[model samples]
Target: MTQVHLLDSIFTRLVAWSIAVCTAVVLILGTLVGAKFEQLSVDMQEAAVNADMATLLDAYRDGGQASLASRIDERLNFRTPSGNAPHYLLVAADGRRVAGDLTDWPGIDTGEMTAIPLPDGSYVHARAVDLPAGQRLLVARESAMDEMVLNEIGIAFVIGGLFVVLAVGVAGRITAGRLSKRVGRINAAFKNPDERRLERLDRDRNAQDEIGELTRHSSEALQRLNRLVDAHRDTLDQIAHEMRTPLMHLDARLLRAIRTAPDDAAAQGLVDARGDIRTVIATLESLLDISHSEANRGDPRGLEPVDLSAMIENIADLYAGSAEETGHRFEVDIAPGVTVRGEEMQLTRLVTNLLDNAFKYTQSGGTVCVELVAEGPVLTVADTGPGVPVEDRDRIFERFIRAKGNHGASGGSGLGLALARAIARRHGLVLRLKPTLRGACFEVRPESTVDAG
Candidate 1:
C-alpha cells in the first residue's frame, strides 16, 4: 500500500507559504520599527542639546565667557537616565578648545543636530551655536545607549518570529498526519479491489465531515456492487449445474449410438457429434469454475498451506510424455518448499491451464520452460512459438474472448486463462501474460505492479 505522508501534499504547501509570508512581514515590520526608534532617539537627544545650548547662552550674557565655560563643565558632570553624561566643546576665536571634553572643533554647521563619531566607535548627537565675541559652544548627548536599545529590539523580534513559525509548522504536521492515517484506513480496502476485499471499515463515518461522507458513500457503493455480483454468480452457478447433467446423458446416448452404427461413416459422424458435446460441457465447467473462484475471493475458510513445488512437479510429470511424443523439449526448474496458502485443486488447474496453452501452440522441435521460485512463489511458463499480438494480450484473459491468429489455441472455448486468473486472484495472486523476445510467457506472482486485466 502506498501511504500518503504529511510532507508530500497540503501540509508542505501550508508550511512553505506560511514561512514565506511570515519572513516577509517580519523583515518589513522590523526595518520600520527600528528606523522609527532611531528617529525618536535623535529627536529627543537634539531637543535636550538645544535646551542646554540656550541656557549656556544665558550664562554667557550674564557672567561673560568664563560663566559660559563654567556652565559647560557643570552640565558634563551630570549624567542622564541612560547613565551617560553629555559631551561639550567650547572654542575661542583662535579655534582652540576653551574648557570641554572635545579636543578640536568637529566639522558641523552651527544650529543643526549632528552626530559626531568618537574615537571609541560610538556617536554623540550634538548641536553647535556660533556665540558672542567670535567664540562657539557645542552641546551633545551620547546616542550609543539608544543604539543598544535598538539592537535588543531587533534581536527579540527575530527570535520571537522564528519561534512562532516553527510552532505553526509542528502543529500543521501533527494535524496532517492524523488526517492522513484516518483517510488511509478508510480507503485501503478499496484500493485492493482485485481480491474483492470489503472489510467493514468505519473511521468517523458519522461525524459529518467530508471524509466521513466519503467513507459512507464508498461503503454503500461497494455493498451494492457486491450484492449485484453475488446475485449474478448465484444465477450462473445454478444454470451451469442444471445444464451439466443433461449434457452428460447426451454424451452417454452418443456413445451408445456410435457402438450401434451400421457403417464407419455413420460411426464417425456420431463420434464427431460426441466430441462437439464434450466441448460444450468443458466450456460450461470452465464458467462454473470462474464463477466459484470469483465468488469466494478473499475468503480464507477453505485455504491451506499447499506445497506449490510438489504440485507443479506432479503436473509436469504427467505432461512429460506428451511433450516427448510431440518431439518438443520440456524444461522444468522447480524450487522446493515453495508453499503458499491457497486451494491446491484450483492452483493445480491454474498451472495446468498455462502449461496446456503453452504446449498447444508450440510446434515440434520447439521448447517449453517452467520455472518456480521460492520467493514470491513466482511461477513462469514460456513457450517457443508465435507469441500473442499486443492488441490481444489483455482481452485474452477476458471471459469468452479469444485471439484468432498466431498463438490462439484451436478448439478452445476461451475460458481457460480466465478461469486461471480468477483462481489466482482468489488466492491473492496475479497471473499475467509476460511479453518475451520470441514466443509467449505467463507469470504468476503474489502481486503485480500494474493491472494485468
Candidate 2:
C-alpha cells in the first residue's frame, strides 16, 4: 500500500481552513474592541483636562496672573485622584511660558485636544483654553495605562490563536487516521466482493454522512456485479462442458476412418480432417483454461510455491533435442534461486507455449534463446524468426488471432499466445512482447513482490 502523508489528507485541509477563519475573526474583533476602548479612554481624558482648564481660568479671572501661576504650580506638584500627575503650562500674550513644567506654548487652538511632542521623544495628550489676558492654559497627561492595556490584549490574542491552531492540527491527524482505515477497508472489500466482507461495512450504513451513503451504495453495486459475473462464468463453463463430449467422439471416429482408408490420397484427406478436428479441440480446451483461470483469479487455492528457475531449465532441456533435429540452435540461460508462488502446471504451460511457437516459426538454422533473470523474477524468450508485424502485434495475444503469413506454414490453432497470456495473468505476471530487429522477443515479469506470494 502506498503511504499517505498527513498534510495531504482531507482532514488536514478542513482543520487548516477552520484555523484560518478563526484567526481572521479574532483579529477583526480584537481590532474593534481595542478601538472602542481607546476611544472611551480618550473621551475620559478629555473631560478631566477640560475641568482642570476651567478651574485655572477661574483663578486667573479672580486674582490675576500671579494667583493663576501659584495655582498651576500647586496642581502640577500634586497627583490627581486617579494617581496620574497632570502637567500645566500658562503662556503669556508674548507666547512665553509664564509657569509650570512646559517650556513653551503648544501649536494648537484653544479648547482643542492634541498630542504634544516632548523633547524626550515621548508625547502627552493636552487640551488648551484661552484666558482673560490672551494667555493660554494647557493641561496635559501621559497615556501609559491605555497603551499597557492594548499591548496585553494583543499578546493574549496571539497566544489564544496559536493554541486553537495546535489543537485543530492534532484533532485533524486523529480524524485522518480513522478515515484512512475506513477507506482501506472499502478498497479491500471491493477487490474481492465476498458476502461476509461486504457485510462488515453495514455497521456504518446508518450514519448520516457522505461516507455512509458511499459505503451503502458500493456494497449494493458489488453484490449485483458479483452475481452477474457468477452467472456468466457458470454459463460459459456449462457450454464448454457440453461441447467437449461431442468433439471427443468426432475425433475418435475420424481417427478410425483414417486408419481404414483404401488409398494414400483418401487416407491423407482423412488425416487432414482429423488434424483440423484436433486443432478445434485444442482451441476449445485453451478457451476453457483461460475462463477458469480468470474466474479464480484471486482464489488462494489456485496458488502454490514453485521453483521458477528449475521449472524453466527442465522445460528448456526437454525441447533441446527437438530443436537439434529441426536444425535450430536452442540456448537456455537460467538464473538460480528464483522462485514464485503460482500454479506449477500453468507456469510450465506458459513456458512451453512460447518455446513451441518460437521453434515452429523459425526456419532451419535459426536460433531460439530462453533467459531467466533473478531481478524482477523476469523471463525472456527470443527467436531468430520473422518478427510479428507492427499491425498484428497488439492483436496477437487475442484468442483465435494469428498474423497474416503465419496461418498455413505454422498450422497453429491461434490460441498459443493467448493461452500463454492468460496463464501469465493467473500468476500475476505481465507478459509483454518487446520490439526486436530480427525476431519476436517476449518478456514475463511479476508486477510486484506481493504477487510473488
Best by lDDT: 1
- Per-residue lDDT tens digits for candidate 2, residues 1-453, read 344576786766787787788778778877887898889878877887888888888888899899999999898778654425678888888888999898877687877789887666767789888777677778987776767777788788778877876777678767767777777667767766777778877766776788888888888887787787788779888988789889889989988988899999999998898888887878888988888777766644447789999999889889999888999999899999899889999999999999988888888899999999998888999999888888999999998888877533676778889889888887778888988998999989876742562
| Residues 1-453, model 1: lDDT tens digits | 666564677656776787778788888888999999989988888887888778988999999999988988887777666724688899998998997888878889998888887767778888888987789888877876788899999998899878877777677667766666656756665654323344434545675877778878877776676677679878887898789989999999999999999999999999999999999999888988998898877756578999999999999999999999999999999999889989999999999999998888888999999999876768999999888888898798999887778555476888989999999999988888887899999999986434532
As for candidate 1, its clashing pairs are none
After the best TM-score superposition of candidate 1, give how far the Cα of residue 39 lies from its true spot, in angstroms: 3.4
For candidate 2, the 10 contiguous residues with the lowest summed lDDT are: 293-302
lDDT of 2: 0.82
Clash count list over all predictions: 0, 0
